[model samples]
Target: MAQPHIAKVLVVGSVNGHLADFFAKVKKLDARYGPFSILLVVGNLFANSDDHAEEVISLLKNEITVSVMTYAVVGDRPLPRRVRERASLKSGEICNNLVILSGQGVLQTSEGVKIAYLGGRYISQCLAETSNSSIENSANAAEPTDRVAVDPENSVSVDKGNSTAGNNEEKGTAGSEISKEEKGSAASESINEGKDDTISDSPPDDDESTHAHFDKLAVADLISQVAAENEKTFQKAIAQPSIDILLTFDWPYGAAATSPHTASDLSPPSTQFASNKISHLCAAIMPRYHFAAGEESFYERQPWKYSDRISIGRGSSAVPHFTRFIGLGAVNASRNEKQRWFYAMNVNPLRNISQGTSAPNELPANCTTNPLFRFGKIARVLDTKSLPRVLSAIDSSGGGNEASLSNRGGQGKRPPPPLNYICHGCNQPGHWISDCPVKGQNKRQRSDSSPPSGYVCHKCKKQGHWRSDCPADSSTSSGHASDALSKCWFCLANPDVDQNLMAAIGEEAYVAMAKGALVAGGSAKDGFHGHFSPIPGGGHVLIVPIVHTDSLRRACEGSDNAGADQRLSAEIDRWTEAVSALFAEYDCAPLIFETSRCLPHVHTTLQMIPIPNAKAESVKPALEDLCKADGLALAADYPPAQHDGYFALRDPASGNDLFLHMPKGSKSFNLELGRKLAARILGVPAREHWRQCVVSEDKEAAERDRFIAAFSKHDFTR
Candidate 1:
């Protein structure tokens, strides 16, 4: 058997012209973790002053010997004129072992690591400049040096921009040049030849800039370049190319939103300087690892999974992609506390790695939703299906109007829809009928102001109108209550309920095994498989109210009979107490939580998960920290006289109660907040989403049985 080959790579933060110290640290790291195949330097390579110009000149002239092949990108400062001139002349290589990839494109190393790099700060003016027809015509007239061509042997060819081109055998560089189809250049020129222009006489320089700011055309070109390379490499229009690493100078906007830390913790200056252009680029090129600098503090965001799009009936495989964004502190910068400036990892190229079945633990527990998904540009760029809808929406607003177009751009709020346009489906003014939230509902039911044919009043249980139209006494019927129990999966009365998951039945409430349990089944001696639960069957249980109500509080409040309300609330409390006692028997502590919403048709269930006794102390602080980071206010008291939704948690071991009030119409509140918090505290973050933790039906039945056996003695209902 042969051992698998792994490529070792090292990435460091801004060098800031500390060449001597940086090289010394690299040599030590190389000896310890490397003999690394390559070294990637992000952010500022040299200081703004002329103090280090001599050192840069010496290194560029081959006087300095670097232990590894070095590649650097332009950062916050302009590159030295001498070094830039030498690198451009030598096709991006400054010396024997050092190279400067100053342009925006992908570079594939000898070890097959595909790195996508975008250098410099963002210039907002570039958007306006690129939109100018005269400047665009002039740019089109200039000899295009950045055209991407396909190579038969290499599959793709790059230009002076150092795109996804093959390696140059003569220069020992990563990219090679290709012959221009004079026809291709002529076609582009012909399209813009007769355009009205103010500056058509002066053509823009064709040379790549070493300036501290990048042009918007370069960003668009990079996106198109990456897309073209994917088409060439995979031979499919929608195939996602695997980019191992992405290097950028500044952090992407909203990078700290989903991270465990807040923007203030990761340097507010850096956060303020973040760019949405970078965010758009990151979304387009979903790299495995994204490294950035310019921030003086080190911060590592939780890994985020890319939104998976359905395949377009093409033969392309749907592979899940994830990106881990790491912001490194400046090298040798003075700080109150020591921060990490270097990162090293061993990786196998995506081509070398198998694209087969992945293990259950493949995704990290701390993985989160992509922060860049909020940007609409990402949807327009990556999702071709949405293009028609977007274009139609824009066209309907006005005839080629820039103001109407701006409404659909980025994250900016749009003006209210015209009063003349109303959605017949929901009787709303903001959206078209086809885009209505209730579009799937029967048209007769919406327009007739009457319930459906089989409708029964939940309040009166009479066949006719809904609970809202019920003629029952106002005092007896709660205005907010609705009957959804007949269709609810958690309701025992539902014929479709999974009986195999039911553990115990009571007069007011019932106990059942949680579907997609966060914890795995095993004994403590078996070791932690992903969760901290020591009890068998993962110790995940759910207590559900037998009545159809949005929440337990609503069930109690809406009941006309006081006795029935008290009994329902007490029965739920007893079930929770019983489960806590059962977990105590196994030396585990119970973490019980519930989300009570005022919304109609919401089935409320209390989730009870067991954690190790040792970890119980850390749960409250972790939850509080996450809430604070997410800008959620946790109050010591429950919601006061509010019909809105609120989250409640009980920590019996710590004797603490916490509540987060979710006001009505607050779309920002995350419904999965509790599950995410529990997953993090229990060390099963990957299983936060119930869909990911679902097991087979047979396995679910077995877990239910095991839990019932363990809770037999503690079953108060029996």
Candidate 2:
């Protein structure tokens, strides 16, 4: 029964050491727009070189008392290194009211507005480290960063010779102690690592390059730290994710070209603003409101609508998703002091908006040809996957014209659709892709759309179809997005899903107690009734790999070489030995198994079911008989381990276990067969069904505590 209520959010441009000006601006706004909640500050928050930066900091700590909660993105020049270390190193308090918004940082206001941030312009990490020389001498962060970002803008007035924001500082804080292993730390470079460096070819130490390099490096490092702390949340969001207000430090590359805006209308320096990475990230996040600062000009686009291309559900809708992007001008660079404008956004629950008579705040998307010329390069120097092959081909031409390919944006340039392709069903302005109302007129209409149905969207506050699943339409789904981690089970890749259920972390793997284990304690006194009692078997833990991968056999298939694969194959053996050791310590037998359903995520699921030696002896024969009945090869002896009906199989010679699936078919069939045979081998008829094993967190934690207490020495987590 939750309904949409209007919440106002304010966004300010840069505050380049002008903390007093910032406080003044918010005060004036409060008098005019008295009741706004979140205040987003873009541009350079703490001036790296400003002598008065300390005064500004003091003002923030002592003078500023406005209740409108504020968050600032790291701008062209990030906060002082001390400040960056404070925010990134510990996520420490910047001030009582204003917090520095780093990557993955969110500010939840008292009035219930959640603002998410992904800041710093796109820059390559190689360019950042190689050129800056600080990372080369010794770049070890309390917060790890391997990112490429643009140089700080020249508009930032700094001390005559000071390196902007610790680019070439080559020193950590005094008295800070770092171990030998942590010094000069480098991330395992993805295959795409050197692609961005190809553009520069040599280390460029120019002011522009250095500024770009430092901002991106710092921001990326901050982001990595934030992600590490919230590992469970970020891993889960690889699939469908929604956010309310998303803040970026720069306008998304090519975003100005989406509607009637030309390149000149967005920013005068559009030529220097080519970033396929930023553009790709903004598009992927799908936020309701996207805001950016440090642009040359100010722009507030009408809400733009887009359709979900890959409809995961049974059907789709043409009432295109409503997303708005706003750009605020630099506070110092504005034409007039009074010309600077802060945007006010209204947030409301989707249910109230959908039910109320008022339509979504929309503007005619002036689909016009943009006149952008040269721009920044589209980087493929981050990850190997999803490297635009066609774009790579264009860049390889060596014409030095990255803008030629930037025009297409992420989806590649095709001419806009013919204007005549209208939706005949809805009679709306835009042509429908899948949102047409009359797609199936002869079929039964959805009963849940009626007002009197008394239905509410479980995801959001909308009365909609019971059969339909909806995305977070406005990020107004009651609880903050960061707090809503229950929707996904395994997608949160870290071992700390719950503090109690986590047992130990291995070099590349971790252990967690399975919920509602196959055979565990029944009840506290009565024993084995349901989700209430902990599983009695002490070794029923899941061996989870840290990386997002599918099958163990195919994890390094395309990426690893022969030697790498051999090592990886050996790690599988080590994992098996670890589980075997755990069970043997308690005089039990280890029945480790793995299976994966084709899901959006790549993380593989491996379960270690420990049982009595007698039950364990029956498993091999039970699996053999079940495979024979299903016409599946004996899993352990099967030649191919990565086939469709995949389940874990051990190789006798190498002692390495790989997933063995039936040659072909969906994974579910063989997985079920494997689980059923496993249950039969263990002589547990009730636990034969996978669905029945799903249990509450408390029971899982109880089992986890026992394992943790027994095997505390095996913990290898960073």
RMSD of each: 20.8, 24.4
611-682 per-residue lDDT for model 2 (tens digits): 555455566667667767756665343334333435665422244564445444332244445456556765
Task: Name the best candidate (by lDDT).
Answer: 1
lDDT of 1 at 429: 69
Which regions of candidate 1 fall more than 4 Å away from where they truly are? Answer: 1-5, 124-211, 230-238, 261-270, 307-320, 335-337, 354-361, 376-718
Q: Estimate TM-scores for all models.
A: 0.47, 0.36
In angstroms, the error of model 1 at 28 is: 3.0
Clashing pairs in 1: 158-165, 365-686
Q: Return the TM-score for candidate 1, rounded to 2 decimals.
A: 0.47
The best candidate in terms of TM-score? 1
After TM-score superposition, what is the CA distance of residue 407 in candidate 2 from its true location, in Å? Answer: 25
